[model samples]
Target: MLTLAISLLVAGAVSGILAGLFGIGGGAILVPVLVQALAIMEIDESIRMHLAIATSLGIVVPTSIRSFLAHRKHGAVDMALLKSWAFVLPLGAIFASAVAAVISGASLKWIFTGIATVVGIKMLLNRPGWIVASDLPAQPARSAYGLLIGFFSTLMGVGGGIMNNTFMMLHNQPIKRAVATSSGVGVLISIPAVIGLIVAGWQRPELPPLSLGYVNMMAVALIMPISILAAPVGARIAHAAPKRALEISFGIFLLVVAAQFGWTLLN
Candidate 1:
C-alpha cells in the first residue's frame, strides 16, 4: 500500500506536468503507467485497461482545468473554438467510452498503442511551415473534425490535445493557442468520458476493489491533487520552452510509451 501510494504520487507528478505542457490531459502518460502499476498490484487483467483509462480521465478533469485557466490568463485560448467544439466533442467522447466498455481490454490497449504511435510520429516529423489551410474548417466540416477528435481521443484515453494540436497547426494556428484551446477540449471530453465509463462499467464483477465502475477510486484519490497542483507549473514551462524542442521531446516520450504498451501486448 505504501509503495502503491508512492508510485501514484510519482505518476501524478509526471502526468500533471505533461498535461499542462502538452495539453494531452495526461492520459497519454498516465494510462500506460497505471496499467503497469495496477497489474503489479494484482489488479484483474480483464479490467486493468478500463480502470486505467477511466481513472486517467478522472485525473484530467482537474489537471486540464488548471492548464486551461493558466492559458486563459495568458489570452492564449480561443473561446470561439471552444464554443464550436463544446457540444459535439463531449457527445463523441461519451459515445466512444460506451463503445469501449464492450470491447476487450487487450483491444483497447492495441487501439491506444496504434494511435499514440501515429500521433507521435506526426509530431516528430512536423515542421513549422506545414499548413493545410489558413483557417479552421467551417460548419459541417468543422463539426465532423471535432467529432473525430473527441471520439479518437476518448478511445485512446487522451485529452484530445494530440489531435487538436495537430489539426490546429495544420490549419495555421499558433502553437500556443492550439495548446491552450486543446486544454479546454480536454476538460470538455473528460467530464463526459468519466461519466460514460462509470455508467458503462456499472455493476461489473471483474473490477478492482474501491472501483467506481471502471475507475479506481484509490488511484484518483492518490493522484488527483498532485496532478492538479503540478499542472500550473507545467503550463508555465510550456510558455518558456522552445516550441520545436518541446514537441519533439513529447513525441519521443509518446513513442516510448507506445513501445511499452506494445511489448506488454506481445508478452
Candidate 2:
C-alpha cells in the first residue's frame, strides 16, 4: 500500500506538469501511470483499465476547471461556442462512459493505443499542413465535431483539450484562442464523464479496494491536489521554453506509452 501510494504521488506530480506543458490534460499520462501502479498491487486485469480511466477523470475535474478559469480571464475562451454546446458535450461524454461499461478492458486499451499513436505521430511531425478546413463549419457540423471530441475524450480519459485544440486550430482559429477555449471544453466534458463512470461500474465485483465503482477515490485523493499545483509549473516552463523541442519530447513520450499498452494487449 505504501508503494502504491508513493507511485501515485509521483504520477500526480508528473501528470500535472504534463497537463500544463501539453495543454492536453493529465489523463493522457495518468491513465497509463495508474495502470502500472495498480499492476503492482496485483489488481485484476479486467477492471484495471476502467479504474484507471475513472480515477483520471476524477482528477481531471479540478485541473480542467483551474485551466479553464485561468484561460477565461484572458478573454480568449469562445463564449458563444461554449454556450452552444451546453447540452451536447455532456451527452457525448455520458454516452461514451455507458459504452465503456459493456466493452472489454482490452478493447479500451486498443482504442487508447491507436489514438495515442496517431496523436503522437502528429506531434512528432509538427506539420503545418495536417489541417482539414479553413473556417469553422456550419451549425450541425460544428456540433458533430464537438460531440466526437467529448465522446473520445471521455473514452480516453482525457480533458477534451487534445482533440478540441487541434480541431479549432485546423479550422483557422488562432492558437491562443484555440488553447484557451479547449480548456473550457475540458471543464464541460470531464465532470459528467466522472459521474457516468461511477454509475457505469457501480457495484462491480471486480473493483479493487478503496474503489467506488470504476473510480478509486484513494488514487484521486493521492493524485489530484499535487497535480493541480504542478500544472502551473509546467505552463511556466512552456511559456519560457522552445515549444518545438517540447512538442517533440512529449510526442516521443506518447509513442512510448502507446508501445507499452500495445505490449500489454499482446501478452
Candidate 3:
C-alpha cells in the first residue's frame, strides 16, 4: 500500500510538471509510465495497456477541467465552439474505447509504436510547415472533427490535443486559442472516454486492484490534484511562449516517446 501510494505520488508530480511545461494533459507521458508501474505492482501484462489507458483518462478528466477553467480565466477558450461540439465528442469517445478493447494488446502496442515513430520522425525533422492562422468565427461541423478527435484521442491515448490544435490552426485560429480551445474539448473527450472505458472493462477479469471497470480509481485519486493544480501554470506558460517553439518541442518529445513505445514492443 505504501509503495502504491508512492508510485501514484511520483506519477502525479511527473504528470503535473509535464502538464505545466507543455499544454498537453500529460497522458502522453503518463500512459507508458503507468503501464510499467502497474507491471511492477504485478499487474497482468495483457491488460496493463487497457488499464493504463483507462486510468489515464480517468485522471485526465479533472485535470482537463482544471485546465479548461484556467484557460477560461485567461479568456482563451471558445465557449461557443465547445458548446456546439460537445454533443458529438462523447460518441467518438465511445467508439474509440470499444475499438481499443477489441484489439489485442500486442497488436495495440504495434499500433502505438507506429504512431510514436511518426511523431518522432516529424519531430526530428523539425517540420516548419505552419498551419494558416484565422479566426473567421466559423466552427467545424460537430460530427466531423468531434468524432475524429475522439477516435484518435482514445486510440492514441493522448487526448485530442494534437488533432484539435491542427484543425484549429489550419482553419486559421490563433495558436493560443487553438491550444486553449483544444484543452476545453479535451474535457469533453475525456468524460465519456473514461466512462466508456469503465463500461467496456466492467466485466474484464484479471484487472489490478482498486479498479473501477477499466479505469483505476487509485490512479485517478493520486494524479488528479497535482495535474489540476499545475494546469494553470501551464496555461500561463502557454500564454507567454512562442507558439512555434512549443509545437516543435512537442514534436520532438513525441519522437522520443514513440521510440520508447516501439522499443517496448520489440523487447
Candidate 4:
C-alpha cells in the first residue's frame, strides 16, 4: 500500500507540473503511464483502460484547479471568452459521452489509438500554422469552435488545450490568454465525461479495486493532491520559458507519449 501510494504520488506530481506548463490536462502523460504501472501492480485488464482514463481525468480536476488559479492570478485568462464558449463545452461533453456508450471497449481502444497517433503526427509536422488574425470570426463562430474542441476533448480525455489554444492563437488572442482559457475548458469537459463514464460502466463486468464505475477512486485519491501541488511549479516554468522552445519540446513529448500508447495497444 505504501509503495502504491508513493508511485501514484510521483505520477501525479509529474502530471500536474506538465498540466500547468501546457495549460492542458496531463492525461496524455498520465493515462499511458498509469495504465502500464497499474498493470505492473497486477491490476486486471478487464477495465485497465477505463481506470487509466478515468483516474487520469480525476487527477486532472485538481491539477487544473491549481493551474487555472495560477494563470488567473497572472491575468492570463479571457473571462469574457470563457463565458461565451462555456455553454458549448458541456454540450459537447454530453455528446461525446453518448457516443462513448455506443462504442465497444475494443472500438474505444482503436479510437484512442487512432486519435493519439494523428494528433501526435500533427504536432510533429508543425502543420496548421497560426490562424490568420484578421480572419477571427464573430461570436457565433467562436462558439462553434468551442463545441468542436469540446467534442474531440471528451472523446480523448485531453482538456481541449491544443484545439482551443490553436483556435485562439489563430484569431489573434494572445498566447497567455489562450492557455488560460484552455484551463477553464478542462473543468467543463471533465464533469460530463466522468458522469458519462459512470453511466456507461455501471454494473458492467469486471472492474478493478476502488472503482467508481470506470473510475478508480484509489488512483484518484492518490494522484489529485500531488498534481495540485506541483502545478504551480510548472506554471512558473511556463511563464518564464521561451515560447517556441516550449512548444517544440512539448510537441516532442506528445509524440513520445503517442508512440508509447500505440505500443501498448499493439502489445
Candidate 5:
C-alpha cells in the first residue's frame, strides 16, 4: 500500500505537468501507470483496465477544470464551440459508460491501444498539411464529432483533449488554440465519464480497496491534489514553448505504450 501510494504520487506530479504542458487531463500518463500499479496489487486482469480507466476519469475532474481555467485566462479557448458541445459530449460519455458495461476488458485494451497507435503516429508525423475538413462543420455534424470525442475518450480513459486537438487542428485550428479548446472538452467529459464508469462497474467483485465501482477512490485521493496543483505550471509553459520537440517526445511515449499493450495482446 505504501509503495503504491508513492508510485501514484510520482505519477500524479508527472501527469500534472504533462496535462498543463499538453492541454491534456493526464490520462495518458495515469491510465498505464494505474494498470501497472493495480497489477502489483494483484487486481484481476479481467477488470484492471476498466478500473484504471474509471479511476483516471475520476482523477481528471479537477485537473481538467484547472487546466481549462489556466488556458482560458490566456484567451485561447473557443467558448462558443464548447457551449455547442456541452450537452452532447456528456451524452456521449454516458452512452459510452453504458457500452462499457457490456464490453470485455481485453476489448477495451485493444481499443485504447489502437487509439494510442493512431494518435502517436499522428504526433510523430506532425504534418501541417493533414486537413481532413476545411472547417468544423455545422451542428448535428458538430454534435456527431462531440459524440465521438466523448465516446472514445470515455472508453479509453483520456480527457477528450487528444481527439479534440486532432479534430480541431485538422479543421485548421491553431495548435495553441486547439490545445486550449481541448482542455474545455476535458471538463465536459470528466465528471460524466466518472459517473458513467462507476455505474457500469457497480457491484463488481474483486475490485481493490476503496473502489466505487471501477473507480478507485484511494487512487483518486492520492493523484488528484498533486495533479491539480501542477497543472497551472504546465499551462503557463505551453503558451510559450516550442511544440515540435514536445510533440515528438509525447509521440514516442504513446507509441512505446502502445507497443507494450500490443505485446500483452499478442502474448
Candidate 6:
C-alpha cells in the first residue's frame, strides 16, 4: 500500500507538470505509467489497460479543470473554438470509450503505442510557422475533426490536447491559443469518457478492489489532488518558457516511452 501510494503521488506530480507544460492533460504520460504501476500491483492483465485508461481519464477531470482556469486567466484560451467543439466531442468520446471497453487489452496497448509514436514524432518535427490554412475548417470538416479527436483520444487514454493542439496549429492558431483551448477540450473529453468507462466496465470481473468499472477509486483519490494543485504551476511555466526546447524534450520522452512499451509487447 505504501509503495502504491508513493507511485500514485509521483505519477500525479509528473502528470501535472506535463499537463501544464504541453497542454496535453497529462494522460499521455499517466496512462503508460499507470499501466506499469498496476502491473506491479498484480492487477489482472486482461483489464490493466482499461483500468489505466479509465483511471487516467478520472485524473484528467481535475487536472484539466485547473489548467483550463489558469490558461483562461491568461486570456490565451479560444472560447469560440471550445464552444464550437464541445457538444460533438463528448459524443465521440462516449462512442469510442464504449468500444474500448470491449476490446482486448493487448489491442488497446498497441493502439496507444501507435498514437504515442505518431504524436511524439509530430511534436519533434513541428515548427512554429507551420500552417495548412489561414482559418479553422468549416462545417462538416470541423465536425469531423472534433469527432475524430474525441474518439481517438479517449481510446488512447488522452484528453484530446495533443491532437487538438496540432489541429489548431494547422489552422494557423497561435500556440498559446491552441494550448489553452486544448485544456478546455480535455475537460470536455474526460468527463464523458470517465462516465462511459465506468458504465462499460461495471460488471467486469477481476478488477482491482475499489474499482468502479475500470476506474480505480483509490488511484483517483491518491492522484487527483496533487495533479490539480501542480497543474497551475506548470501552466505558469509554460507561458514563461521557451516552447521549442520543451516540445523537443517532451517529444523525446514520449518516444522513449513508446519504445519501451513496444519492446515489452514484443518480449
lDDT for model 1, please.
0.88
Off by over 4 Å in 3: 1-10, 17-23, 120-129, 132-142, 243-249
Point out the higher-scoring one by TM-score: 2 or 5: 5
Per-candidate TM equals 0.96, 0.93, 0.86, 0.87, 0.97, 0.96
Better of 1 and 6 by lDDT: 6
Q: How close is each model in CA RMSD to the real structure?
A: 1.3, 1.7, 2.9, 2.6, 1.2, 1.2
The lDDT of each candidate is: 0.88, 0.83, 0.73, 0.74, 0.90, 0.90
**Mind giving the per-residue lDDT tens digits that candidate 2 earns over 155-203?**
9989888787678878888666776677778788989999999999999
Clashes of each: 0, 0, 5, 0, 1, 0
Question: What is the per-residue lDDT of model 4 for residues 1-267, given as tens digits with 9 covering 90 to 100?
Answer: 577667677878877887778788777777767777777877667566666776677777777777888989988888887788779988887787777666654455566667666656655554345557655577787788888887877677667776777777777776767777778878777777788777766776677767787777877887887788888888888788745666677677766766666676678
lDDT (C-alpha) at residue 213 in model 4: 75
**TM-score, predicted candidate 4 vs. hidden true structure:** 0.87
**Tens-digit per-residue lDDT, 146-194, candidate 6:** 9999999999999999999999998999888888888999999999999
Ranking by lDDT: 5, 6, 1, 2, 4, 3
On a 0 to 100 scale, what is the lDDT of residue 67 in model 1? 90
Compared with the true structure, what per-residue lDDT tens digits does model 1 show for residues 1-267? 778678789989988987788776888888987888888888789888888889999888889999999888989998999899889999999999989889999999999999999989998999989999999999989989999999988888878988898999999999888988999999999989999999988989888788898888888998999999999888898888866787788789889988988998999
Q: Tens digits of per-residue lDDT for model 3 on 93-143? A: 889889877886766666666766665564455333554543433455546
How far out, in Å, is residue 43 in model 1?
A: 1.7
Q: Give model 1 RMSD, 1 decimal.
A: 1.3
Model 2 poorest 10 in a row by lDDT: 234-243
